[model samples]
Target chain A: MTESPRVVGRRTDVSGPGLAGAVTDLVADCAPEMDDVLVVPDCHYAFHPSTGMVTNPDVVEALVEALASTTDVTLALPDSQWVEDAPSMLGYDALADRTGVETLALGEADTVERTVRIDDERHTVTVPKPLDEQAVVAVPTLRADPDLAAAMVTVAEAATGSRERSDVVAASAVVDPEFVLLDGTYTFTGAPHKGRFLVAGTDAPAVDRAVAPVAGLKPKAVDYLRPFGVGREAIEGLHAEDLAAELPHEQTDPNGGEQPAVMGAGYRLYAKMTGDLVPPQFSGGSDD
Target chain B: MSDLRVGLLGAGNIGTVHLQSTRGIDGASVVAAADVVPDNRARAEKQGVPRTYEDYTDLLAEEDLDAAIVALPPFLHAEATVAAAEAGCHVFVEKPFARTVEEGQRMLDAAEANDVSLGVDHTIRYQPEVQTLKEQYDAGRIGHVPLASIARINNGPFAAPPARQPVSGWMLDPDATGGGALMDLGVHLFDVLEHFFGELTVEYAHVDASMDLPYEDSALVVVSTEAGTQATVSAGFFQWETPPEITGYFRLEGVADTLRSEDHLPKQFMAHAAKSALENVSKRARGQEPAYFKPTYYYQAHYRALKDFLDAVAAGEEPPVNGAAGLRMVEHVQTAYEMAEGTRAAANAGANVEVTDD
Candidate 1:
């Protein structure tokens, strides 16, 4: 039998203070050298940290602070904009200003196309040039996304070209990170709700396997996690606490399939009927 | 008494809305549409347009249009309007009117020289809740209003995850848009404010960009028509709007009572959608096309604006929102830009900026 992945996590508030000590229990388990590390936060677009739609810059700040104090690890936040300038708009510029760290705009940065095979077909994706030398860390917002673990794992793939789900999965295998940290500070279960859970581990799928139940999803239930063979009884060492039974489970879909499934038929019908250009954030009804 | 043959210049998002709105207009038919994007043109063709053009100039030259809806970008507005007017077609252009006052004036000059009607789509005041607020306030249901603020926020030219397309090239370009959210959205609020209180003056202004884009994503400007009354126009592109929920804050406060946009807004989108869908089915069965955008009042406002303009044109009367109104709104936004720059300069020179002039 293959050894289970060690996954550890903490339940903490939005407070940045002592976050390093709080998260240390899990970081030490990864046993990383913390040298020349590049941090990729799941801030693909410009969303406020408060919305829990993106990674909290405050939490990233604390993580950087703790790393600088204890280790000689050189850290950089490098990313390309998916919709808008994520670093500047998502408060990472302010994070850099406060911490004297720099954000590398990957769009302007030199890139090389990497090929990876997924579903027995080779797909090409562009990644930053510096991935060879840098130890990587991924900070993704924990939510009930369809490809939750895999999306977080391949957050830095194909900035300039077609970035479909297959390209993302194929790219995750190429730029495998040393550690994965999920910010459940406010989890988006169909929409945002306060999950207040921070999950961490070295193996992305394994961590997802262990923490899936906490977020109201089973490991086998996740298609990405299932492929990794990271299902129930997969974890060798784990510490998990979540609002699973209390908070939104699987998705924010308590209505059970009545609502439009995220840009589904209901949205398309509304857009066609109304001639609306802008996509609705949540499609049910007007609050008024 | 024949239907007006119309040509749609841009078949993108708003252009498509205008195209759809034409179905409901009494005597306007969108016969031809033009857009650089094949997808956009295809979308318009799917909406029953018989002909399509890659360049709007081709459409203006080839099609016998009575009126042209210049739904192109801000940079192309003056040129398209001028060409359409020169072609002896009345022009109904989307807002920000033109990139600058000069461009607006140039378009106005061309229209006058060609003897063509010019209409600007400023749909904010047409919103039911805003109209209701104005009606109630004028009736003294809310006594003498001391202060007011109108805000319109949306995620401009951008979307959250699951969106795979590239961001719009011209939206973030200062040269193309003339300004950012301030120009795109503030034009609507400026028009709305003038509808309530005539002859307003800018007191102070500020524009901010959270992203590294060329223009500001958020803008706040203070204005007043009378000596004591304070009104602000807060417009931004930093907001996430779901359908049925246009993120806005329309408030008018009087000595006697307070008026909020929500109090007057259309409610329960899903319920309304179901009702409208059912009604549309019946209307379709009756051998008449049903209204498509009846579910949302904001979208319906877009229809009303076009309908009002077409109705006025058909009567050979001056459109209610004419070239001059669009130019005035453009001038207001330009003043706000200048004032924002001046205010920032004053603050940088070690002088404290006051909140209000009076």
Candidate 2:
């Protein structure tokens, strides 16, 4: 039987107490199983009540520096606006100066194709039509031809300053890929594109699960995913199921299960689909 | 078993500690423990106490006890002590004698009428280091106690439940614990300050009691005594580890000194200047005993207090740390809580609320 693809989910929510350590623990747990990991900057979420506005720029820089030096991983990022706001990107020039990986910016040039440019090298790549407008820049690399892997590796090595050849190898592998990781929050309303299937990366599903109690989403939300075209057919389809199972029942129950009105009739329906109706992992606990 | 039998009321965390302390006293034995909770009775029974009573009244009525340690919740402190006092028992009550000054006054009146020696557990002041500091302050070793500051920040007691628990828990419930860290721990600092500087009024103070719990958790209290001495007392449930440290800084006009001690532990100077002051105090208190001039005081002060109380009971004399002393500490603590409440109300209303001095 074919082994399940070894995937690593990065937790980008950097707000609240002990979250950074939690993310570190999650990454450490996934390290052994992961073939190629995508390390994103610790993202900022505006609505977290506990820590109103947290900026763990140091954490992102640390993660990027550590991933660049130690692991062979595919690092996919959003546009310049998103990248510039990222803590890791502030050190991109220095990282690029040391590592030879080329930093690329992707944007819409016209209806036909998207434009990709290496900031330092001034190198650009333009792909053909029928492209996913919302797919972002990483889509082109995932769909790129096999021969482009060598060129992409050379570019990534120059941009990242990683001496290890495997860093380039993972970067090359993710370029022009078949599957696209989408934000689970927006997937339902967002349109799907041709040739690429939408999947929740390690972080998106976790966030979706984490926010479920607070947001008051129902089983219909997971069932709604297939129809909304955002998530998987069932919550079990997400990779976090095994990890979710291990979390304490108290930590997982949102609203302290005190307000049954919020959970509604969808509770049992979602319970069957998710197997465990709640995100077992807590933001703050002894284990965390 | 026939001599100096002690009846313990409450059987909670502090009550259990009192029972442990009593076990070590030569002349005293805990014969009976009483609590409202069945589990508490079972726990007391496990400690080898022969009798356990569900009602404290029944325990007081049945046992021919010479003394009783009143360790019930703050709101119940007055009632329990008054009951124990009327039963002709010398009472050893926990700190912060009552929830309010009026209640404390009434309880003290009852003890006085009954002619029972009533002592409050002002444990910190009984510490050897604290005693040494008090001796120094009194002997004018530190020149003159100008500005004194006591700071205590602890993660709270081992019995404090996790933060996630409901706000109505015993510790958070004002009716039960009487006002969080300010009442629970601040009383210790107040007792020490009163011991060193006599009676005082709060001149300027700021307290953040409404932060996390329903009761006040943090307080910064500034007091001015009749002699015009100034003292700042700060306490909070903010530390993350055990055996919480209680530290103090005293800035005299001619000299400055610092003193630190943890619960049931040795007291020592953390700064060089404090060392010199402590040495001077030791030399004067214990002349020619140079071994006592080590800039540190070592002794289990709580155990000493327990021993003293036991000795007083045997001799039919008054306990050294009387309930009136505990009442005064509670009065100062209530003022601090009022300060915090006034500040919070003013902040919420977007205007300054005048805090009345009691």
Candidate 3:
């Protein structure tokens, strides 16, 4: 019998103050003794922090400082050859200057090819050098689709260059960070929302399971989280169900916030019957 | 006049709209279409466009077309427009009409040499709110408007939430699209701004990219007309907008009062869609083709602009929004670009001077 992974939680007004203090307290029990800490931020694309599509750069800044209390911190970055220079675009370089953290590209960083087999397939995932040797602190935004703050959770699996179910599972097994922080500052349900909450835990999958329901995502719907086992304990005053009740649920599918074509048609017909124009997006020829 | 034979050049998203819209209008019809993508060409064929081609030049040469809609990428705008003009066809080109003033002029010169009508699809001014704003301002209800501001920001070139169309790479490339948000969105704004305030002079401009793109994704351009009406235009692709709540804020301040686009916009879309759809149903019953996306004023604006251009072609007259008009807006965009470059150079020089002082 395997012991259950530990999951913890924290809540704060993302707008006010003590964000860095909150981060320090939430991650207190997870990781601090390690010499080099690799902080992975949700930066698949350079979406502005205010939109909440990407992880709040401020939160990343705070987490880096907290990690630096004991030792050196390096923010993880994907290679420019693969995707956009997300670190530079998201102003992580500036964040590094302020927090005194170094940014290293995962592809360029020293890596050992580790073969991880999940179910019927095997993948050789290339993880950052520091993670290959030491403890890891990863933060992901809760998108309405999944932290239900998750938007395909591409930031974690971007280095692998595959965005499907198996690829994410493969990477998680290899990197298995000691601490995971879910950024719920701005959540997207059917719309862009100011979702002000933070979650933390040593087990990445356990942390996500506890946080996912708060963002309107069912834990069972996520195939990847099933491997981590069910038990979750909130380290602080944070309840996923209580928060889930407050959010709008126009897009709460565990498969990500993808609305089918038929939904668009039905919505269009509804707007037509009700004597209203469907949103400008459906008509196309909007901007650019 | 007999049906004006129209050839749609580049049957992508908008091309299909044109093909479908052509069926609604009586005096003009899309006879053939061209697109490099097989899916787009097949879509045109499905829309009942008689012939489809892999290249637009083929569509221009083989068919006896009276007019051609140049909906190809901005890089190919000059070449495609020149070919259509030289082929004795009136040309209706899409936005960013040309990459630069030189290219815009070249297309205009070709049209002049060929003696064919050249129209630009500047559709914003046709939106119901915009039309209302123009009428009220012209009627002097606003009383000597001295200042105006407009912003067109959305998740452009990329999808936000309700993802439908995958972004075309050319739209993001500065060289291919001529420019970024300013060229793609600002050109349309400039055309409409000129319509309100005749002949604007570039006052100031600042262009920056938030995303990791070679070109600017956000821009603020300020201009002043001979009448002393100064307008500030904010255009960006950085914004994350949930549809039904897009940020297209346009406002005008005058001595008497203020006017806003939001005030004139259709309220509670559900009710408006019902009425609009019913009207379209009545039109279809009488052999009049039902308007597509009738409730969406933006799409209807496209339909109106295309219809107006076809009317001009059928009547053998210059389009209401012609090639020279397109050229002037292109020049305005170039002037703004030059001003932004100059501003950046001066700021750098100032920093260097401070460094020398130290």
Candidate 4:
């Protein structure tokens, strides 16, 4: 017998009290039985939240406090490609102190392999052993990673030490997170702008699909998410407001189209006037 | 005179800077380059280096170089410098000289044994503002300077905005880099301090790491020179909002007046550059050779230091900032670390225990 798919829980507030209350409400509604929960936020690097590159730490703190009610929460992040210094570099150390949430470098953690299906093919996926077996929550920012969007599914895949797009897709299924806390406190398309809202759901695929509109994308267009059996329906949410109305949904020119060209030219002229080396954009690549 | 042919070792961030600085010099040419990373080697090639190698040893062996810039990581500085000295080439090494004072001594020994000139890129002293400050202090512009303080802090060797790429892990590793902000930045301050004052004795130190990263990301060093001048040196890795957003100040408090390096800075960097270009053009038109200096004064320190080393190599003279000076900086850093370690140990020993003179 198949269990009924869980509904989504959302809250829209900019204040600290509002965010913490919203996250607590969402966690309580989605998975009340959660114990020993692992929070995987989009902490790719130590970029400021204004970049829309990483999840705001405020969102992570709210989730930690929310999870602390029924479970022990640990903030887990995958190691960076260059080195294992992502924790301090990303400013998670400060968050840990403020929230009292223990931090884990998932890359340094041991892995365990599990079988999962991807596009009708069974693949062996290795995930951090401690995290794989525990209840996980992915708190991702509202940002379009060029064509693909970074949300729960991407955050789940990042908990493992995999780089392949297909592997990330497969790993997302293996972790099988209990909830996705979509931190739309700020959203990134071409640039970051405050899109204050949060989307929470247990169904990773469904949550990703439902939030796709917030970034002005059809769920069907996200390539890695295509193979999953997720649907585009907001079954249930704490905040019954229309999220699409609140979303700016201004899509970026993925090619870096005209804006970069204009900026590059301006900088070149500035360099010439100053007798400075015609900055790299005008000089072109060293190879060129 | 023939050009001073040079080989570049390690085409990473600072290595790339050295490659650019070496290129800007009139009688210096980078003939060969080496780096473990393929991308770095490719970048070096693009910077007009004709030949590239995956290993620095290969570059040193194959290239008939008059001198080599040891721009590899702090860990490799000793091995690479020794190899260059053994190859009958002068060596200009990037700082913190070495991971330890002992390692720095070994590199110095190698240079002396081979009779090759050794120069450390202690570029802080070469900065125009720093030089101006020093000139003013020496000329009694700030009469009988009694107190001085130097601080250089930035969110570097790691930070966003300015960083086009991710920083390598080795920079954060205590074993690889010796120490964090203290070793990375303290040595530069020490060089500049010693340049203004005579010899310095490390009085006390305190180091703090924001996380459990094996080493301190921030440091505070109290030092005094033999000439009765006391100074405080503060350095950190987590101090700025962007690249080159450094909080560096060298202030001399004298009986007669107060002098600051910030006061001597070019009012507007671009305007100064434009004025310098115009002056150079005017001089060239009058059949006078234009004044020669680094293209960008911001990085002119690195260029000047390297150019001085090449000049010394060409003249068969000693480098102004020789191996001994590099070793002195390392020794100062070593003393500071030892003092910090002693403080930590004392604190730990005092924990959970009470002492009373009964």
Candidate 5:
């Protein structure tokens, strides 16, 4: 029988407990059959000034150190944001300099020019898109601008020569005041796509079940992930039956916590204004 | 006094509630109950009903009754009520009267032909709070009523323990319940609205019904009367942990008095401007008291309706809450349901269906 795939997670929140560490412990306790490990920083940290993307320099150093000691390990990052600032080139240069590990850039011919300003050395390198055969380009948070969303529909229609609007998936951002940056939304119309994590196999129910708690979100908050070909119905179909016996009992509290009073008040106004018998926002979907 | 025997058609929840209500109402006795379910017969026995029959005709034929309470499901209401009317019995039926306007008309026809007193249990109309509103409006205290709103948010009937039966259960089934909250609760609100203002013409309405359920669990209906009075009724069963509460408030154009009910018991009418208006009216009419005053007792309005119906039955005169009033309520509910169902279908079809907007 084929073994379960090794999954990696990144802790997005800064103040809370590290999500990666939590995931590792939970996986060890609940899903022992799957082999997983958390990678930590070793020496040199990586930072992207433009997008505010930060990676532990020591973690990259440890990964390069591991390449010398281990041969069969596959290097993986959390998402597309990690690779925004010449990540492959920087990683390759670091590894080659430290441990003579041959760096091969494999992919189609699309040039990405970057100027690296190091101590007394300036170098420009043109790299191609990472190939599916050699290394996969994973984009965990691929948020779409509203303009891009409309453009995607136009492009999809042009490619397929069909006027069907249902054939396109749209992505958007749902920016709340508190968590403005990380809030993203996606929608898929016709079929699922690749280049993103497939939480589970063909079973939409299983995929949905594996997402929450693993992703640290309620099922309703995950609707934005639908447009990324994540199988929304599968996620929606997930019930308590699909979960493992050891999963913590869901909270029974009515209000959940001291959520923003405006959320509740706004929802009430929306209900009255729309004459909606039940407020759609409060129905556990994206109120945005 | 001779035994005032009665037969009951329908052993459903409402039927059982009626049975309990009937026990308290003097001079009425439920002799036999008939229902399609054998379990319903057991229910009757459990409720201390003397005799039970599977067929309503059997109960009508066997029981020497003064009246029959037709509490069957809505679809079966017209047939059972018409049968009771033909059998020469005063009929007390549940709200919406029948499933369709046509069916309601037929029941009315039967009652008219037999010359039997037909009273509808538009229970909300009989609600003391609603009665207070009606009394004030009729007394011209709340001068020409311009806009009224009736809002009822209850745990859908099926949310209750007794109602939480299988999917095929009577209340859950559309054919049995007739049309969800709009029919069940909306009927009552419509009756109250029509009672306050004369017959209404539904200018526009927007209804958003349930998707997963076979019937609508919620409805939002807006209607206007022929006399230019507008009203909105929002009914639903999504409330989680609250006992049902119905709030009816209307705005009068010229009247400055504010009518408020505390704990739905004592109704208070207060107004600084209307005090002079009231005093002038009271002075003009020597013996007549100022109509805009506080209610003396609790639920006096329902008691009045009950007394009126009983008085009409005793005098062989037409009952106050008649078939036509019930029919008008049913028609409004039907229109709302149709609007909701149509909107939902269009939404599913991916068509831009614009709901009625304010």
Candidate 6:
């Protein structure tokens, strides 16, 4: 196998008929050898896709359908430290129940502790037994982490092993997923920006490297992704350069909490003077 | 001086808002907070609450406070309020008062038996823009009002951006939340309409469930008051766009002209604040009690409601929005629900019948 895994990229529609096809292509390119696959997707918090905080359920549905064509795929979410009801709280349990796709709450799953070495340091971590599967697919949405280029490694870490932020890279390595699928349909760099693309490869780091530019980050700058050797190229379907050109965009906060005081005051004053309802951004549905 | 000490129950989504709203309010201080979730308790601590409890009953038993804010799920509202009342603490509960009218009555009775004030946070009527429209309507700015309408819509419970606070799963559970939009937002509309036009009779109501969800996600109701004023109210959980795109419309059509809540809203919030601040200063210089709530009325309706309740407590008077008002809103919602059930039953009955060409 190549040190820099062969990465394949394709356009995906979140709601269109093309999702199954794209997801199928990704599974075929990444985990063709495996029969039973454990798929892990980013689901840290109960955040909607519009906010770019968590993965969209549509992406997971497409993946599950695609994998069902050739493999016995079980959707998995590891119950980590922060949330107790991870499966229900993140909404994957409901999706699984709705679609009849068997889901494993990895938090409740039998866990085995193991020692792994990363960057010349040894660490002990607990990962679900499914991480030992011959084919484990690490599927994560494209979003910029304050510390990492993309949240793929962190998602793997969240589902498999340690909660310590620094141990994320080590946990991803320990999980040793055989494939990685990047759900780039909507990437949240700062705010939700549209990429409408998906990519898959055997190398998690190389896949993260490919998606780094899409989320407006340089692969070299992200320290956590350094474990995956550099110089991997993302082979695009149409234009490889177009993906990089679409990146480096800023995500603006919609809540307007951190803005300069004068600007907020001016905005509010304008609304008041004009007898206009405070801007919609400042308005929310009245819930008693 | 933080005289009226208060404790909070259920540090979930709305509880966080209640906790935050207590800050800087005169004569009120949140002394302790309780939540079933440890994470929520931690969050309350972060908000500067000194003590935390896993069970609200424990907090009520231990904390020495004048009142408790019952921001728990609706299923727990009645029981929690009763506990607060028994503990000799006035209870300010989040709306939909209870799961059933009987439960609401029990809560009211508990507060009465204990001689503790019971208030519900029906803050929609306290919104500055809505108040402005109410003022105009009261002053006959739009002539005699015949027809009025109120609507509130949002993406059921989970959509684009999840609620900022940790939303417990109970929000979607019918047993926990009573019904859906009608139970959640309908009570507020009913209360506001009743505030303006007293004693509304639900002439017609229809409800729809967007998905196979357990509860009705939408409600539409037509009502008439004793004065023969007609009003239509609708609430739905299907509002996809929030904040920037307005999802609520409150309007009154009079004989001469129509008045809308939107018209009274300040176009620029910051500009309005500056103007209000200068006006307040002028009033203070003239040795008058300035519009203390002028700045907050624009955005923080909860603060205004809480301030009024706290002031009432300090004065040993009944809260402006008391338990009776809360019960009235619940009664209105129950009637709407009953009407919807009847409609559903009739429609199903029609659907099931076999037509014979005898």
Kindly list the per-residue Cα lDDT of model 2 for residues B1-358, writing each as its tens digit: 3569899999876676676567656688999999998877776776668999999999999999889989887778889999999999898887777878888888889988998888888777776656766676677765665677776666443112111222223554577677767788888888777777788786655665322235555778888876556888888764433122334333333255544333324333335225543454455456432221122231245556666777887888877878878888888887776676677778799986566554
Q: CA RMSD for every model?
A: 5.5, 21.2, 5.6, 7.2, 22.1, 7.3
Task: Write down the TM-score for model 6.
Answer: 0.74
Per-residue lDDT of candidate 2, residues A83-152 (tens digit)? 1222232344444445544343322222232333322232223322212222211211111011111122
Question: All candidates' lDDT scores?
Answer: 0.72, 0.50, 0.73, 0.74, 0.47, 0.72
Candidate 2's docking class is incorrect
lDDT of 1 by residue, A1-288 (tens): 966655666666776554556556556656366676776776655555555656777667766665565554433445544555556666777778788865566556677778877667787777776554466677777655434532334454423333355644555665666777777677655455666667777766666677676656677776544446654633333334325655554343333223356544555565545444222222223221
| Tens digits of per-residue lDDT for model 4, B1-358 | 8999899998876787777667557798999999999988887787678999999999888989999999998999999999999998899999988899889899888988988889999988988889988888889886887788998877655553312346677776788998888888899999988988889988888898654555777899988887678989998776533212247889989888998888977766556756766675566567654333322355667778888888888888999999999999889988888788877887888853322222
TM, every model: 0.82, 0.51, 0.82, 0.72, 0.49, 0.74
DockQ (C-alpha based) per candidate is 0.19, 0.02, 0.19, 0.14, 0.02, 0.08
Task: Write one digit per residue (lDDT tens) for candidate 5, span B1-358.
Answer: 5545678899765566555444544565678999988876776676568899999999998878877888877778888998999999888787768888888889989988998878887766665566666677677785665666776666454322111122334555667667777888788777777776778766545654432355565677777876567877778765433212223343334345645433344323324223533453454456432321112121233334444555567566888898778887788877776676677788899999776544
Interface RMSD of each: 9.2, 24.0, 8.1, 7.5, 22.8, 10.3
Least well predicted 10-residue stretch by lDDT in candidate 6 chain A: A279-288
TM-score of chain B of each: 0.93, 0.78, 0.93, 0.90, 0.76, 0.87
Which 10-residue window of candidate 6 chain B scores lowest in summed lDDT? B159-168
Task: Write model 3 residue lDDT over A62-88, tens digit each, in one string.
Answer: 888777877888888664332345467
Q: Tell me the number of clashing residue pairs for each predicted model.
A: 5, 24, 17, 0, 12, 25
lDDT of 6 by residue, A101-155 (tens): 8887777777677777777878776767777544677777776644342444545
Task: Report lDDT (Cα) of residue A84, candidate 3.
Answer: 48
